[model samples]
Target chain A: MYMSVAELVDAAKKTKKPIYELVIEQEMDTSHNTREEIWDAMGRNLDIMAAAVKKGAEGEGVFSKTGLTGGEAVKIKNYRSAKKTLSGDLMMQAVQNAVSTNEVNSSMGVICATPTAGSSGTLPGVIFTLKDRLDLTRDQMIQFLFTAGGFGMVLANNAGIAGATGGCQAEVGSASAMGAAAAVELAGGTPEQSAEALAMAISNLLGLVCDPVAGLVELPCVKRNAIGVGNALISADMALAGCTNKIPADEVVAAMDKVGKGLPSTLRETGLGGLAATPTGVRMKEKIFGKAVDAKA
Target chain B: MTVNYKSVFDIIGPIMIGPSSSHTAGACAIGRAANSIFQETPTDIVVHYYESFAQTHKGHGTDYAIISGILGFEPDDSRVPYAIGLARDQGINITFIEEPEDSPINHPNTAIIELTNSKDGKKVTVAGCSIGGGTIEIRGIKMNGFDIKPKGPLPILLVPGSEVDQQNVTDQLTALTKVNEKKQYQSAKGDLFEYDLDRRLKPEEVKELAKNNTNLVYL
Candidate 1:
């Protein structure tokens, strides 16, 4: 019944419990599942996420039939190792992890959707990066997922989560928000602060469209996940530094829903507008699919 | 309206092989749903892709995913990549149609599957959509105009056609196990009896039910 972000935070605060713990309690009460069972399931998800990250980072990424994505993650990793990037070590690492996961996704590798498969990279990217920086235990990492899940459920229930329904703002935007909130909670910020982080993260990506080149998630989708990682980290840091969102988390989600609805169908994963319709995108499609649409180009 | 998400798994995971959840995993589930609608294994299938699905199915591997599903493969099965070749080897005739832009269906990730049972020459058309995150909704079934959305873990069966005794079938299944929910649709062709059981019925039991009722469809 308590489905709003504010309500979830309030419940957690009232119980003097972490948001993740409250979510655990709620899951137990509703599903009649044992804590061990829930933890085991989450543990499996983490294992898969970890394995995909490792495989992608190691340059063993499988190729999409379109051949648009495969080894970019390894390229990023190689770049990070050779140079000192402007984003610092942790951010660069996060970017590498994010790209790796999304590349794995593009290659048809098994991945856990951190909301949806299109947005899977953001949470794992930020989490793995913070795992080393924060010295988080495996159990704590799982709890971070729960924390993210808690807010994700709220956003999904309130606004939406699918790209086709709400544009990339729904997929990447919601994932980034969920990742930011979990990052805040992991950093020992208050539940309210976590909500602020979520708001900031989502607000930053408002009006973003789901315009993949050639209508494949490989092109801008994989790279956008890399950006989402940095977006989450920055939002988390801002929230930790006492930055506040003027519009609350729930309202921001509602606004995002409205904006997504207002987007043209072409901008919402239809492949008819934005980057998908660009001349280069058309050229790439022609190169991959050939001039099949025309008798002869 | 709230999406019926059973668990956090609904949010974070389906553990699927994918480039796109809406196009791949969910499409596989829709294919599975289409498979379930058949009385026996379908030897022929004609799929009509709609909107975005028609535009980018190849890039997202929607066609492969659906073919794999028709072959009774899950979304994560490695065989999904080679589903077309496998189906060809199995002697299944496959065809595709790009639904016109003015089609009545509105969902971006939608497909209408026409399946033919080789043995009986029975046919069924399933209009389904991949609603993202490996979830699917069977928007309609062409036999008797059934509008069903399968949301449970159990395999749902749709006995379409008026000749079959709907009450008797429901009673038989309800006697064997609790029927979680039941829905019915009356169309010009027949009465569609849809039942959601608490668990999958035993194969032998399903055989008995099918053997007894000629008009029964299992979906």
Candidate 2:
């Protein structure tokens, strides 16, 4: 509805312009880069993310990857004395309850901040990767996290990362987008290149939701951050390789808001539309009732 | 030629360093704050540990966060691996030391910073904390045994030890009593302003007109 001829671009330039083709205007830009700077940024962010996840697995806060505390480990060890197949429910439960994400914004305190509760794993997951996978020094990782945070801070102000407002696209999508942008910057991509990566992330995750099973953060959310982090890295790689998105990060954020507003409440966090009323949920409810009746006996 | 959206990425794409955006992101703000506090690149730094930042410092990469701050590392610089070595190469000595078990405890994320630049005999002690979301509160800093309090609205942010340091260090602190301060941004509302006929603007804009504009004038 809004139209400015020159603001849109000249008719002659429009014919010559293509989304990816136009990004090469770096010469006229002031955001010059030294190749080494970009690599360090990516390495640093990955380190911090990995470290955060490792911390969560260490049993701080609610994340206890090792479900078998001292009280239960001894009993489980004795019962499985002949442990040949190495099967244990405690191990399974630990995996289930351990090292996941949140449904709303969770606090990392002194560390980097994650988005919605459901995708809390995104930032920390990347940090863990840097620490275990790469040879990044401790300090470099810290700098990288700061750079990545700078990217996220802009988005946190510009975009809404909740399903209730901007949908899963805003939550996981924004995180992925922010990750992609930081990765690009770390790799020496120009500001425009970083924004393109962010755009791709937001567009890819458009229409995502915050539906959790039984209203618990345990299901789907944790895995989503892992996926989102991977996706953002991929997008950053693509952006760095000269690929670009047509939409701006700001525009995509606006679109996310519109889509979220259009989504039905049932499709949001409401249990009615998603996994809440699934067969698993029904079975769990039935088990609860059966246990209550048996206890009366 | 017409500029497209992807064109921007051609200049500045995003970075990929860590998991959480704010924690990792806020670290940059901390670095920036520390950098501003210390005028020159720090040669040596000791980040005192707090219980909250102590246990999780490693996991959150808090150690790296503060180190870059000392080295005057920019938020976008991704070469964090080389960062430590670069800092060392630049004669910047950085280390993390936890408080003694017997010492009095304070905020968990609080840090006691000791920055030394013996080249010019500039030694400073800054105690502060990176309270989440990139917000930093510099409780205080000392040049020597004497505390050099900030006199103006903004605490003395100058990293001292030069001739200017001695002159700026006042024996007594003239604490701000009660005076109207200017707003960060200009508007008809948020901050106090004069609504006189001679609408005063910025120093460049309003000029001394602001001093007389009784409505907008703090006096």
Candidate 3:
């Protein structure tokens, strides 16, 4: 089985199979399960993600318990319908889908944690929004997830995908990278281009911290997911357009790990510093919980 | 080295209800494993939270998730939010111990639960950690006076920890079923015994096999 993005791309090119098929083979070797079983499970996850998207886009999204993130997706939807937006229909749809997924997650609705719950919105967001635009089939959508999962596995093995161990760079940043790589493959780009897409996406979001206000996965988390999808889409386009990444995907992941290690714990989901320590952030926490809280509490 | 991600599902999805997967869904899995390991509903449970969990568990619903798990609620269940009230209604006493930030356990999302059964007053302690992405690892378990590092899912039979014949246990287990692997671990607490077998044993089959050996306890 491949352990790095370089090896994954090499294997994909050598075997003359898509990256998703290679990933499926890896799963078969490890789990001893048939391909159909694995595909059915992934199909279920897609259905869940689609359901959450529909639920979120239907109304002024349900406000989170902390009242930090909600209704942004619906607002964007309305804006797209009523006015000429610079982002265009496809990009706006991607942004809205991403925000809606995170909004559903914040409201305690069921969601598939794509790499992580904190960054769950990116892959499905880009995939579902472009499904019609790309004229993709249901199998193609599942293949998209498999390709993303393959890239995410590479990052997780080389670096990590957790905000606690790494930073927001590892969570949302890795998700964006995974999405970009899958988008490249789905768009019929070469395996080399997919790896380059990964490198581009990650480099764009390097050193981002994970300072959720009040330690809740709302606030900047939801909006960051929207930005993450945008980053993934643009990076995918850049890779498909034949832009070469100076740094390789594997080295970029290692660099992200190093940057994550350099960040203080306060900037890594502890809520002890960064935006969580801001005056307005503290006031919002007190207003929600009816008392001031210590950063170390 | 720490992860065992075998499939696409391990990375892309767990399909759970969540505000935070590390805190909520992963915590629920640990608690659910604890519930199953104890083999009965606990009359009382004491949980200890450490590091990031100690500080932000309330906001992330980590506590709610674990309690709901003890109450046999799935990670995706809607009843998770009201688990505390449900526990009280069932006459289950729950206590939480939040460790100081500096005196925390190694992992940021870690918990140790002590559960006591009502009828026999038997107790078990399970130490687990949520290692992010709605995944968990149960590090150690102390039950029936034995320390077991069970590597597999429940319906396991744990033998009491004593300076007993490892060869004898292996022989007996092999006689009962095909033993895949036998391993011994030494921790600061004491020695732990573990076995990976070719097949999972039913509780009744475990009892039948252990009828002559009083030290074996079905877990």
TM-score of 3: 0.88
Model 1, residue A121: distance off in Å is: 1.1
Off by over 4 Å in 3: A292-296, B102-105, B148-182, B185-192, B195-219
Candidate 1 RMSD to the real structure: 4.3
How high is each candidate's TM-score? 0.87, 0.41, 0.88
Give one digit per residue, the lDDT tens place, for model 1 in A1-297.
348889988997898899988888767754556899888888999998998888888845556667777787887788788998787888989988888888889888899887888898999999999999999999999999988887887887677777777888888888899999999998999989999999999999999999888778888899899888899999999999999989998899999989988998888787768987889888887787776731221
Candidate 1: where is the Cα deviation over 4 Å?
A: A29-32, A59-65, A294-297, B143-183, B187-219
Where model 2 places Cα greater than 4 Å from the true spot, the runs are A1-51, A55-112, A131-134, A282-297, B1-219
A148-212, model 2: which lDDT tens digit per residue? Answer: 44445445444444443344566677667766766665565666676778778778888887554
Candidate 2 overall Cα lDDT vs. reference?
0.45
Error of 1 at B127 (Å): 1.6
lDDT for B143 (candidate 3)? 68
lDDT per residue (tens digit) for residues B1-219 in model 1: 224444576677778896888888888888887776664677898999887787778778888899888778887788998998999887889998876573345577789899987777778888887656676666577653555544433346777655357767877887675676777777666677777654445567788888757666554
Best-matching candidate per DockQ:
3
Over the true interface, candidate 3 deviates by an RMSD, in Å, of: 3.1
Instruction: Encode model 3's per-residue lDDT on A165-200: one tens digit a residue.
Output: 688998899999999999999999999999999999
